[model samples]
Structure formats: structure tokens, C-alpha cells
Target: MPELPEVETVRRTLNELVTGKTISSVTVKLPRIIQRPAEPEVFAQALAGQTIESVERRGKFLRIRMNGLVMVSHLRMEGRYGVYQAHEPVELHTHVIFHFTDGTELRYKDVRQFGTMHLFQPGEELVQKPLMKLGIEPLSSEFTLKAMTDKLSRRTTKIKPLLLNQEYIVGLGNIYVDEALHSAGLHPERTADSLKPAEWKRLHEAIHETLERAVEAGGSSIKSYVNGQGEMGMFQHQLLVYGRKNEPCTRCGTPIDKFVVGGRGTHICSRCQRLPRVKKSSGEV
Candidate 1:
């Protein structure tokens, strides 16, 4: 799944490619992808002749703003959007097509068919499902040291699972969470409230630095993720520990270990991020 950096990269590319292009018509081959208006025909009709104002992102969702309506799209799993000439043949699993007035087409293709689209009025999206429950954007100015402290101070959940919760911090998936935790030299199983002030500061900085660098590299393309231009991200080459199981750690020579935490695959260098020792009962080993 594409997280913040991946989604943000797509938004930037789509804004450049599709902005100012009027929708001549819309075709929804897979009706299940449209969640709003409950009908694919209504969705196509509503978007017809509307000019695309801009493209924005909230967490993992894409907000494609048009004249009077906003289409909230979640490219779940392997969905991808590309701008192609009208004469080009549509590929397999191509579900949605936005025909532009300039003889170009904005096509949406999903191999898993799990992508979703919800239409709404201008301000209605923010107050409704999916978008409403999203927490602060990590890359936004609103996310500060104080905000991070406040969110983490009261939670006893393990750090990895807590960070993965979208209700607490949006845009962090398993990949980035593992990378961020590794970069901070913190164990994935550590409880949130157990961190000291110094550890908290390290974690805060790690999260920001990791995400910024990933965005600069166009996000990690560990799977089939691509931008609107059909280009793969380059950040995977710079990963620290997410997928490097049994590989030597970059900071230390310790072998990276893999395990399951909160039901998600987690990787870490045990030497770098040692788990806290638990006090045992007097008779127990």
C-alpha cells in the first residue's frame, strides 16, 4: 500500500498532468470502485464537463477537486493512475477512465480491484467517513514536538502498533513505521509511555527525517507502486532495515532480525534496539 510519501508524490504528479483539463466523459467499468452516489452512472454524469481544479491528498486518500464536487479516491493495494492518449489501447483491469477534452485520458487501473472512489460536495468530504477519522498529517506544520508528545504520553500500546494506527498518526504504514523505529534506535515492542524525554526527542526527529527523505526520493517502491507518470520510486534503495532481514545493520554491524509485532512483519537490529529487560519472579528464570 502507498503511504504518505507515495500518495503525496501521486498528488503532485496528477496536479501537474490533469489540472485545467476538462472531463469530456467518464467511464466506470467496475461499479464496485465507486462508493458515492451508489451508482456508477451518476458518478460519470456528475463529473462530465467539469474542469479539474486541483489534486490534493489526505493521508493515503486522493482528493481530486472539480468544479463543484470532490472525488475522494483511495488507491487501495495496487491501483495506479496514468495519463494516456485516447488512441492508446486500455490495458487489462483498467477500471475507470476520465476522457479529457484535449483527446487525452486519465485512466485508473487496479489489479486487486480494491480501490474506491467517493464523491462529495466541496466541504462534505472532511466531515464524513474515511477522511473524517484521519489524524494529523506528519508532514504538515501542525505536527510538532508538543503534538507528538501529547499523543504518545498516554498510550501504553507498543510503539510500532501505536504508530501504525491512522487515528493517531495518519500516513504511516508498516514499511515506514519499521524504518522510522529502526532509525530512532528503538525497539518495535517498546511501550509508548516507556520512552524518556530524550528517547521521545529522538523518535520525533527520526519520524520527520525518515518521511522527508522518503518523499524526496519519491517514496519507497517496494512493490508495484508508481506515480501518475508511471515511474517507480527510488527510495527503496536507501532503506535502513524494513526489508533487510539478516543483513548487517547500516549503523552497527549487528544482523537485522525479523519478527511479528501486532501481527505485522517487523525488522530491527537487536544490538541497536535492545528490548527492555523484564523483571522475573523470584523462582522464575
Candidate 2:
């Protein structure tokens, strides 16, 4: 799944590619992807003749702002966007196409068919489902150390899963969460509320620094993710431990290890992310 940095890259690229273009027509080959208006035709009708003002992102969701309408899209797994001329052939698995008056076409393709689209009135999107429950942006000034510590101190869940929860902190998926935890030298299995003040500060800084560098590098292309121009991200070169299992740690020479934590694949360097040994309840030893 494309996390914050990847989705933000898509938004930036798409904004440059499609903004100010009027939607002359819309074709929805996969009606199931449309989650609003109760009908695919209504979605097409609402977008027709409307000019896209800008493309913004809230967490992993893309908001394509148009005249009086906001199209909220979530590219779940393999969803991607591309801009092409009308004369180009429509590729297979292209579920949605927005034809522009300028003869350019914006196409949405999803191999897994898990992507979703919802349309809502301009201001209503923030007050409704999907966007309403999302937490603060990690890159924004609103994500202060105090805010992060306060939120984590209230949760008993393991730090990794807590970080993955969008209700607590948005834009952290499996990949980025692992990267952030590794960068902070914090164990994923640590209790959320058990961190010391210094640990919380390091973790907070790691989250922002990791995400900022990732967004600058266009996000890690660990899977099929790419920008609107179909370019793979460069941040994968800077990854510390997300997919580097069995490889020597960049800092310590300890072999990176992989394990299942909270039912998600996790990577870590045992030497770097050392955790306190837990006391056994009542052992026969």
C-alpha cells in the first residue's frame, strides 16, 4: 500500500498534470469503485463540465477539487494515475477515465481493483467518513512532540500497531511504520504508553524526519507504486531496515531480522532496536 509520502507524491504530480482542466466526459468501467451518489452515472454527471481546481491529499486519500464537488479517492493497493492524449489506447485494467476538453485524458488504473472513490460537497468531505476520523498529518506543524506523546500515552496497544492506526496518526502504513520505528531505534513490540520522555522525543523526531525525507525522495518504491508520471521513487535506496532482513545493519553490523508483529510483517535490527527483557509470570525454571 502506498503510504503518506507516496500518496503525497501522487497528489503533487497529479495536481500539476490535471489542474484547471475541464472534465469533458467521464467513463467508469468499474462501477464498484464509485462509492458515492449511489450510482456511477451520477458521479460522471457531477464531474462533467467541471474544472478541476487542484489536487490535495489528506493522509492517503486524494481530494481532486472541482467546481462545487470534491472527488475523494483512495488508491488502496495498486491504483495509479496517468495523463495521456485522447489518441492513446486505453490500457487494460483502466477503471476510470476523465476526458478533458484539452484532449488530454486522466486515467485511473488498479490491478487489484481495491481502489475507491467518493464524491462529496466541498466542505462536507472533512465532516464525513474517511476524512473525518483521520488524525493529524505527520508532516504538518500540528504534529508536535507534545501531541504525539499525549496520544501515545493514552493507548495500551503496541507501538507499531498504534502508529499504524489512522485514527491516532495518519499516513503511516506498514512500510513507513517499520521504517520509522527502525529509524528511531525503538522496538515495534514496545507498549505504546511505556516510553520515556526522551524515547517519545526521538520517536517523534524520527517520524517527521523519515516522512519528510521520503516525500523528498518521492517515497519508497517497494512495490508497484509510482508517481503520476510513472516514475519509481528513489527513497528505497535510503531505507534502513524495512525490507533488509538478514542484511547487516547500517549502523551496527547486526543482521536485520524479520518477524510478525500485530499480524504485520516487521523488520528490525536486534542490536539497534533492543527491548527490555520481559519477566516470566511463573516459570518452573
Candidate 3:
């Protein structure tokens, strides 16, 4: 799944590719991908004749700001968007096509067919089911150390899963979480409540720094990730620990290790992330 950086990259590319363009028509090859209006016909009708003012991103969702509505889209996995002339042949995986008045068409393709789209009234979008419960973006001013510590305080879940929870902190998935923990030198299995003040500071900084650098690098292309213009991200080459399992650690010569934490495959430098030995108890944290 694309994390914050990847989503942000796509959002920017989408804005550049299709902003100010009027949607002449919309075609949904896979009806299940549309979750809004509870009907495919309504989804298609709502988008028709709507001019896309801009493209925005909230967490991993793409917010297509139309004239009076906001179309929220989530590219779950293997989702990509491209634009081409209307007469041009559509690509193989193209699932949704928005025909523009200028003879251009924006195509959405998802191999897994897991991506989703929701059309809502502009003001009601943030209050809707999908966007209402999301936590703060890492780069937003609303995110601070106090906010991070407060959210993690009452949780007995391990740090890795806690970080993975969208309600706790939005826009984080397996890859970036692993990278953040490894950057902070914190064990993925550590309990959320087990962190010290200093550790929280480091973790917080690591999360922001990792995400910022990633967005700057156009995000990591670990899988079939690409921006709206079919551009691959460059950050994967700069990854510190996400896929370096069994390879030598970047800082220390110790080999990187892989383990399942909270049901997610995690990578870490064992020497840097020396998880504290704790007796297995009924609490299981």
C-alpha cells in the first residue's frame, strides 16, 4: 500500500494533470470501486459536468475538489492514474475513466481492484464515514509531541500496530512504519506505553523526517507504485531498513533482521533495535 509520501506525490501529479479540466463524462468499468451515493448511477451522474478545481490529499486519500463536491479516492494497492487523449486506446488495467471536455481523459487503474471512490458535498466530505475518524497528518501543524504521546499513552498494543492504526496516526502503512521505527532505533515490538520521554521525541522526529524526505524523493517505489503521470518514485533506493533484511545494517555492520510484529513483516537492525527482554505474561503486551 502507498503511504503518505506516495499518496502526496500522486495527489500533486493529479493536480498538475487534471486540475481546471471539466469532466465531460465518467465511466466506471468496475462498479464496486465507487462507494458514494450507494449507487453507481448516482456516482457517475454526480461527477458528470463537474469541473475539478484542484486535487488534494488527506492521508492516503485523493480529494478531487470539484465545483460543489469532493470526490475522495483511495488507491489501496497497485492503483495508478494516467491522462491521455480521448481517442487514444485505454491501457489494460484502466478501471475508471473521466473524459474531459478538452479531449483528454483521466484514467484510474488498479490491478487488485481494491481502490475506492466516494463523492460527497464539499463541506460534508470531512464529516463522512471514511474521512471523519482519521488522525492528523504527520506534516500538519496539528501534530505535536503532546498529541503523539497522548494518543499512545492508554494503549497496551505494541508500537508497531499502534503506529499502523489509521485512527491513531493517519497515512502510515507497513513500509513507512518499519522505516520510522528503524530510523528511531526503536523495536517494533515495544509496547506503546513502554517508551520513555526521550524515545517518544526520537520516534516523533523520525516519523516526520522519514516522511518529509520520502515526499521529497517522490516516495518509495517498493511495489507497483507510480504517480498520476506514471512516474516511479525514487525513495526506495534510499531506504534504510524496510527491505534490507539479512543485509548488513547501514550504521553498524550487524546484519538486518526480519520478524513478524503485530502480524506485519518488520525489518530492523538488531544491534540498533535491541528489544528489551520481558517475561511473557497473560497481558501479552
Candidate 4:
């Protein structure tokens, strides 16, 4: 799954590639991918002749803003978008195609067929299902240390899963969460409330710094992820712990470890991110 940085990269590339282009027609080969209007025809009809104003990203979703409608698209798993000339042969697994007036086409391909598209009137998108429950953007001005502290102070959930919850912090998935936790030198199993003030500060800084650097590097392409231009991300080469299990830690010589936390694969350096000791009952020991 592409995290915040990958999604943001796609948004930026789509904005450059598709904005201001009028949709001459739309073809939805996979009707199930269209979650809105109940019918693919309605979606195609609504988008016809509508000019794409811009492309924005909310968490892992791509918001393709048109004349009067906002098409919210979630590229779940292997879904990707690319622009090609009309004469180009449509590739395998291409589920959606937006034919532009200029003889070019914007194609959506998904190998897993798990991507989704929801159409909405401009303002309603913000108040509706997908976007409504998403939490603050880590890169935005609203994500302050105080804000993070306030949210985590009341939750007892383990830090890894807590950070992965879209309701609390959007755009984080297994990859980035592992990277962030490792960067912070915090154990994945640590309860949120167990964090001290200094630990909270470290976490807050780590999240921001990790995400910012990943975004700059175009996001880690650990899987099949690519930008709208079909470019691979370079951040994976800079990763410290996510896919480097059994390798020596960059911060310490400890071998990186991989285990399951909150049902997701987690990576950390045991020496750098030591779990807190638990007090045992007097008789149990």
C-alpha cells in the first residue's frame, strides 16, 4: 500500500499531467470500482465535458477536482494512473480510462481490482464518508507537537497500531509506521500512554522528519507503487529498518528484527528501541 508520500507524489504528478484537460468521455470497464452514483454510466455522464481543475490528496486518496464535482479515488493496493496518447494500446488490467479532448487519455490500472472511485459535489466530499473521518495531515500546519501529545495521551493502544489508524493520523501504513517508529527509537509495542514527554517529542519529530524526507525522495517503492508518470520512488534505498530485517542497524550495530505487532509486520533494532520492562505480580515471579 502506498503511504502519504507516495499518494502525495501521485497527486502532484496527476495535477501536472491532467489538470485543465477536459474529459471528452469516460469508460469504466470495472463498474465495481465506481462506488458513487450506483451506476458506471452516471459517473461517466457526470464527468463528460467537465474540465479537471486540479488534483489534491487527502491522506492516501486522490481528489481529482473537476468543474463542479470532486472525484475521490483510492488507489488501494496496485492501482496506478498514467497518461498516454490515444493511439497507445491500452495495457492489461486498465479498468478506467478518461479520454481527454486533446487526443490523450488518463488510464487507471489496478492489478488487485481493489481501487475505488466516489463522485461528489464539490463541498460534500469534505463532509462525507471517506474524507470526513480522516485525521490531520502530518505535513500540514495543523499537526503540532501539542496536537500529537493531546491525541496520544488518552489512548492506551500500542504506538504502532495507533499511528496506523487513519482516524488518528491519515496516510500512514505499515511501511512508514515501521520507519517512523524505528527512527524515533521507540518500540512498536509500547502503549501510547506509556510515552514520556521526551518520547512524545521524539515521536512527533520523527513522524514529520520521516514523512518529509520520504516525500522528497518520492516515497519508498517497496512494492509495485509508482507515480502518475509511472516513475518509481527512491526512498526505499534510504530506509533504515522497514525491509532491512537481520541487517545491522544504522544507528547501532544491533541486527534489525522483524515481528508482528497489532497484526502488522513490524521492524526495529532491539538495542535502539528497547521495550519497557513490565512489573510482575509479587507471587507470579
lDDT of candidates 1 onward, in order: 0.94, 0.93, 0.90, 0.93
Tens digits of per-residue lDDT, candidate 1, 83-114, equal 99999999999999999999999999999999
In model 4, the runs with Cα more than 4 Å from the true position are: 280-285
lDDT of 3: 0.90
Model 1 TM: 0.97
Candidate 1 Cα outliers beyond 4 Å, as residue runs: 280-285
lDDT measured at residue 276 in model 4 versus the true structure, 0 to 100: 81
lDDT string, candidate 4, 10-45, tens digits: 999999999999999999999999999899999999
Residue 209 displacement (Å), model 1: 0.7
Give candidate 4's whole-model lDDT: 0.93
Best by TM-score: 4
> Which residues of candidate 3, in runs, are more than 4 Å off?
279-285
Hey, what RMSD does candidate 2 come out at? 1.7
What is the C-alpha lDDT profile of model 3 across 1-285, one tens digit per residue? Answer: 999999999999988989999998899898999988778888888888999999999999889999988999999988888899999988787899999999999999999999999989887989987999999788899789999999996688899999999987999988899889988989998898888999999999999999999999999998899888888999999988889888898899799898898888989998999899877989786
Superposed by TM-score, candidate 1 places the C-alpha of residue 242 at a distance from the truth, in angstroms, of 0.9
Kindly provide the TM-score of model 4 when superposed on the true structure, using C-alpha atoms: 0.98
How accurate locally is residue 41 in candidate 2, as Cα lDDT from 0 to 100? 99
